[model samples]
Structure formats: C-alpha cells, structure tokens
Target: MEGNHSAHGAFILLGFSDRPHLERILFVVLLTLVGNTTIILVSRLDPHLHTPMYFFLTHLSFLDLSFTTSSIPQLLYNLAGHDKTISYAGCAVQLCLSLGLGGVECLLLAVMAYDRFVAVCKPLHYMVIMHPQLCLGLVSLAWGCGVANSLIMSPMTLWLPRCGHRKVDHFLCEMPALIRLACVNTAVVEGIAFILAVGIVLSPLAFILVSYGYIVRAVLSIQSSSGRHKVFNTCGSHLTVVSLFYGNIIYMYMQPGASASQDQGKLLTLFYNIVTPLLNPLIYTLRNKEVKGALRRLIWGNLHLRKTI
Candidate 1:
C-alpha cells in the first residue's frame, strides 16, 4: 500500500479494478450528465415551466449535473486506462462538491414537497405562498446548509492521517471510505457524522412524508375523481424521485456502520450518483404533460424555422 501513495500526495482509487467488465458498464454515467443538462435547458427555455416547481427542478438538475461531473469523469478516466491515482487536491474537491450537492438535494427535495403541499392543499394561494422571493430564499437556504455540511465534514475527514495507506476501496472519495483510511481512532468523527446524517438526511425525509400526508388528506377531500387523479399525477414523479434518492441515501448513510460491505457500498454509490440522476429527468419528463408539450414545441418550433429558411 505504500507504493499507492505518492510523495506529492496522491491516492490510488481501487474502484472496480478487479472487475473490468463492471467498469465498462459504468460508462452510463455519461448519460446521467447529458440527461441532467437537458432538464436544465428545457426548464429554462419553456415559459410554461416557469412555476415554482420547475424552478426547484432546475436547481435540482444543476445539482445532479455538478454532483455527477465532480466524480464520474475521474472514475471513467481511471477505468479507461491504467492510471487510477487522484491528486490529493482532486480527491478533496470531489469529496466536498459531492457532499455539498448531495446535502442540497436532500433539503431541496423537502422544499419541493412543501411546494406540492401548498399547491394541492391551498391551490388558490399557491402562487401567493410560494412567491418568487420565497422560492429564491428557500433555494438559497438549501445551498447554504449544504455548503455548511461539506465544510464541517470534508475537512475533518480529509485531515485524518492515512499513514501511507492511500488506496481508497471505493470509486470516489466518500466520507465513509475516507474515514476508513485514518490511521488513528475515528470514533469521534463517526459519531459526529451520524448526528449530522440524522439532521441532514432523516429530517428532510420526515418533512417530505408529513407534507405528503397533508397532501393525501387534501386529495381525499376533493369531490371529483379527476381532480384527485390530476393531483396524484402532478406529484407522483416527485414521490418516485424522493423514494429513489432517499431510500439509497438512508441505507448508505444511516446505517450504524459507514458501509457494511465495500462492494455493496460501491454499487449503492453508483446508483445514486449515476442511475438516480439519469432517471430524474426521465421521470419528470415522461410523467409531466407540461414538460412533454414544451419539449415537442421546442423541437417542432426549431424544425419549422429550419424549413422556412
């Protein structure tokens, strides 16, 4: 392991090196990047999507894009060739960005849930309640919280002395994997991390569930079945995304152990890092009628202009 650490402070990423085939399949991360970019562009270009929901969605897409880009490109580069080493600075940036973006997503999802709750329970006041100023403030708060989490956690994790043990068992420089590298006792760090996890992960999730509970009651009170279905359709995509994002995150972070199994840890990380981002755009676009219409208009509008020329 001494050879894995360089004099200039580099860490060897031992990500799926033993399984070359799996590395090849992980290239799907490219699609994750593209999909997130499309969501950002479409949401901005379509005037019909100028509501608070799409506003939050645009931020979510940006976070996903930044989050995946921070790690996946390096992973792919390592997988593509023999060089599996990441500079100490590079690893630190990846860890910080991923942590910050992930934290933001958790809080943002809760914000979106609240937006849904207002839209459903108090339709007449939805616009007044979720005004532009409030939306911006909420998003800013989420970003601030995420940045604070990363500042608190990333530095502590990175400060641990590896003592020449620099080979990370997983693909990216995650908190749990980095913690495992410390030569000294990490019980204190682990405890702090667990506490933060509860605050950052579980708290938002509970909020989402509670918001949905109110939403459910409101839907039940609607006399028309079509109204109920419409409300469900509007929110189902968000629910699906919340389940996918939080389920994997809770299992990965909320466990007593940082990661029970290194192999399992890699797969779960890959799922959220790659698969979830890829699916988010698909889930929203396919399930959302407004987005689909906007996309069609954008496409045919361009086509018609070209034909006229």
Candidate 2:
C-alpha cells in the first residue's frame, strides 16, 4: 500500500496550459459559487418559495456548488501559477466528491422532473402525491445512491497501478483521466465503470424524458392558450437545465477509453463543470417568475428592515 501511494505521490494537472487565455475565462467559477449559494439562501429564506419544486432546486444548487468546488479551486490554482501538482490524496477526495455530487445531481434532476410531472399532470392531487415525506425520501435516496457510487468507483479507479505515470491529461481527477494512467489493462474496470455510469447518468435521463413526456401531454390538453403557456413557462427552465447538464455528462462519461479525444474531453469537462453551474442560477432565476418575485421580495424586505433600523 505504501509503495502504491508513493509510486504516484502527486499528479500534474495538465489543464488547458497550452491555451493560457482559456484559464483567464475559468475565473467565472467564482460567479458559479455565488449564484448557487444565492439560490440555496433565497429558497430557504423566502416562504413563498417553499414548495416541492424549490425544495428540490435548493438541493440541486447545493449539488452543483459541491460538484464545482470539488475540483475547480485546484484547477484554477493550477492555471493561475506554476504549481500544478496535486497530492494523491487530494486527487482521491476530488474524484469521490465530484463523482458523488454529479450522481446526486443526475438523480435530483430526475426527481425535479417528477415533481413537475405531478404538478402539471395531477394538479389537484399534486400536494398529496408529492408530499413532504416523499420529497425527503426521494432526495435521501439520490444522496445515498450517489455516495454508494463514489465509494465503489473512487477506490477502484485510484487503486489501479499507475506504474510511475503521474501526469493527468485533464484538469481534475476524473475517472477516465485516471484510468488512462494505469499500467495494466483496464478493460474489466472500464466495463464496471461503464455499467455504473449507465445507471447513474443514462437511467435518470431516461426517467426525465418520460416525466416530461407526460408533462407535455398534460400541458397540451389545457383548453386555454394562456394556461398552456403558463405550464410551458414553468417547465422551460428545468428542460433547459437538463439539456445543458445531461448533454455534457453523456459526452464525457458514456464513451470510456481511447476513442474519446483528450482535448475534446478537457473542453467538455470545463464546460460541464464551470459553465453549467454558472448557467443554472441564471436559467432558474431569469426564466422563473416565481423565483424572480421571491428575490425581489427578499431584497426589498432586507432594504426595508435596514431603513427601519
């Protein structure tokens, strides 16, 4: 075990160093952190935002925040200066957190899709169907599944014998990049990883699609055009978020092995980790009138309280 740990004590994250300008752009991760934090705070503070949708959204924001934080700071540090080396332990933690949080987001998004489906298709029974207990259970299950996935995959990936190769082609300690470092053939491990990826990534995506199918039908059945428009408006933000998240995830994880281009993989990972989290808050806040109104109320109330003081 000591030999294994010492074999590759540290990894050099060769992230976009060739394109120095791109590193400057990645500082936007700070905005991603603030945006997700605001979503969580606003959702908790505002009574009007206390609904099933926002309940799930708060968790989602937390997952995005965690997912981005797991690796971005090190990545930014690597980009900013000469020291790009990360300890083996740091890489392991990053891998576990990123994998677990990512899995949680995938499942949480599907849960959100189900929440939307209930609200749209069973409007009268929405509360009864998606009660607080069920919401909690769903979230707990997502979290549990994600943690299990990380426990299973992180150890397996890190355990692979690197045989002295310590340079990770990508920014973070992602599974694919680490797998490439192994001295032995990784076909069996990759197979297991692929199966797990399908369960974590593809299954939730399929469930989201099915939920949205029912939602679309229910929206179309509305007799009034205005009614239909309202329903679509409520769902559009979630749909956009799902597209952005899942598309990049699928491209990154689904194709495991040498066939995937390292350059393309790095770029996709950057977009997925950095841009997706940043856009999530903008998508939810800008397109969601309920959230916008809640923000306005929260801000005004804060200002009014200060004036009274």
Candidate 3:
C-alpha cells in the first residue's frame, strides 16, 4: 500500500481529462486534423508535385504528423482515463522524438527558404541545383540533423536524478518539466539545454534570414510589376509560416530562467509545442493556392466517387 501510494504520487500523467467533456471535443478536433494532413500529404506526392515547394510542403506535413504522434496519442490515452503520468521510459522516448522533430522542423524551414531563393532568383538552374537527389539529401539531412541534436540533449537531460516530486504540470513531458523534477542541481543540465536549444535555432535562423534577403533582392530585380507581385506573394506565405514558428520559439527559449517570476512558461510552450503544429497544415494550404486547389479537387473527386459507388 505504501509503494502504491508512492507510485500514485509520481502518477503517470492522467493528462488533461479533468474537464471530461473537453476530452471528446479535443479528440475529434485533433483527429480530424491528423486525417486531413495525411490526405493532403499523400495527394501532394502524386508525381504532379516534383517541385521544390510541394516537396517542402510535404515535409512540413510529415513533421506535423511526427510532432502530434510524439505527444497527442499519449495525451488522448490519458484523456480516456488511462495512466496520467508517463513511465520514466515513455517520457524519455517522448522527449527525444518531440525535441528531434521540433529541432528538425526549425532547420527544414530554413532549407525551404533557401529553396525559395533558388526558385525565384536562379530559375534556370533551380532544377539542376535542387535535383531529385539533392532535394532528397536536404530532406534527409534535416531529419538526421534533428535526431543528432536530440541525441545530444535527451540523454544529457534524462541522466539527471529525479529524487523529488516528478509531476509535470503540463500534459507533455517537456525538458524543462523533467529537469525541474530532478532532485539534483539542474543548473548544469539547464545550461546545456539552453546552449543546445540556441544551437538548434540560431544557425538555421541565420541561414533562413540570409536566404530571404537574397530572395527579396531577386524579387526586386523583376522589372515587371506582375512578376514582383507573384514573387512577393509566395515569399509572404513563407514569411508568415517562419514568423509563427520562430515567434513562439524565441519567446519560449529567450527566457534566461529569471522568468521563474511567473507561471507563464507553460503557456508560452503551448504556443510552439502544441498549438503551432496543429495550425501548420492550415497555414500552408491557405497560403498556397496550389495546395488549396489540390485539396478542393481531392475533396470533389472523392465525393464524386462516393456518389458513383
């Protein structure tokens, strides 16, 4: 009974099911999104999408799938009245995958920005430069880079001693949450995480910014107003997506820990970790007419098939 009590005190997350009714609603909402994104990505790969833009878009969909899969299924199980807290092993797995996907996503966006620059400025060489093999290499590199980063941080993080209370206030097992639970002094671990976090974000961000600057100059060189408008529109969409991701990330990581001043850290984390990925497919589809048209055609064709059947 005493052992049982201790386990409950360290209870694997019950997740956010305290509200009961919200569980069903969130479940439907998130599941629908997951399904929609899967369909969209599958459609994007239908040979018609050999271009760099759609290639990156599909990668984004894949990232969103990974991001949600890393956390949501467990969260749903918790909502459905399963174990609330994750086992130590499960938390470690989740942390690695989640952080890896997140870090890779940061880099992938930078790659997309560079792809855009090539598409706009060096249209003649765009195909030759971003050939099938190189594009594959870039995408593969993004995944490799992300996992490498997590490999560095996750073990560094999980090795800390959890000698005290281990209840993570948030639904997901964040690095900060796990670090805070450690009974040992976490200053060193936190410092390492901080350095790694910046490493993950800053280099990719610098690349992205430089790529966009060149892209803007290239866009400006287009003497035709119509050509300028089209280029600007495409860049605008990419810019918006970049801003949404980085805004939340910079907000979350920019804190140098003195901000223990409030409970707002959890709220800020939600913006990037939970909320941003949920809305990513929507942002991409809405901004890119090609994606929107493809989705509409897909929906229409599916409906036509259902009627025929």
Best-fitting candidate, measured by TM-score? 2
TM-score of each: 0.95, 0.96, 0.84
Rate residue 3 of model 2 by lDDT. Answer: 44
Q: lDDT tens string, model 1, 1-309?
A: 443353238889999878877877777877888888888888999899999999999999998888788898899888778999999899999889977988999999999999999999999999999999999999999999999999999888888777788899989988888888777788888888789889999999999999999999999899998898889888999999999999888877765244567788888888898889999999998888888898899999999999999
Q: Which stretches of candidate 2 lie over 4 Å from their true place?
A: 1-8
What lDDT score is found at residue 220 in candidate 1? 84
lDDT of 3 by residue, 1-309 (tens): 443333224435534445455455445447535744764565564555558777887787677777767777877777766568777677878889877988888889988998898989899999999998888899899899899978987887676665456677667776666666566677776677677777778778889999988988888788999888878777887888788888766665545343442245555555565566666666666666666666677778889999999
As for lDDT, the candidate ahead, 1 or 2, is: 2
Runs with alpha carbons beyond 4 Å of true place in candidate 3 = 1-25, 28-32, 35-45, 254-262, 300-309
Ranking by lDDT: 2, 1, 3
Query: What is candidate 3's CA lDDT for residue 222?
Result: 87
Error of 2 at 176 (Å): 0.7
lDDT accuracy of residue 36 in candidate 3: 45
lDDT of 3 at 296: 72
lDDT for residue 193 in candidate 1, whole number 0-100 = 79
Preferred candidate (lDDT higher): 2 or 3:
2
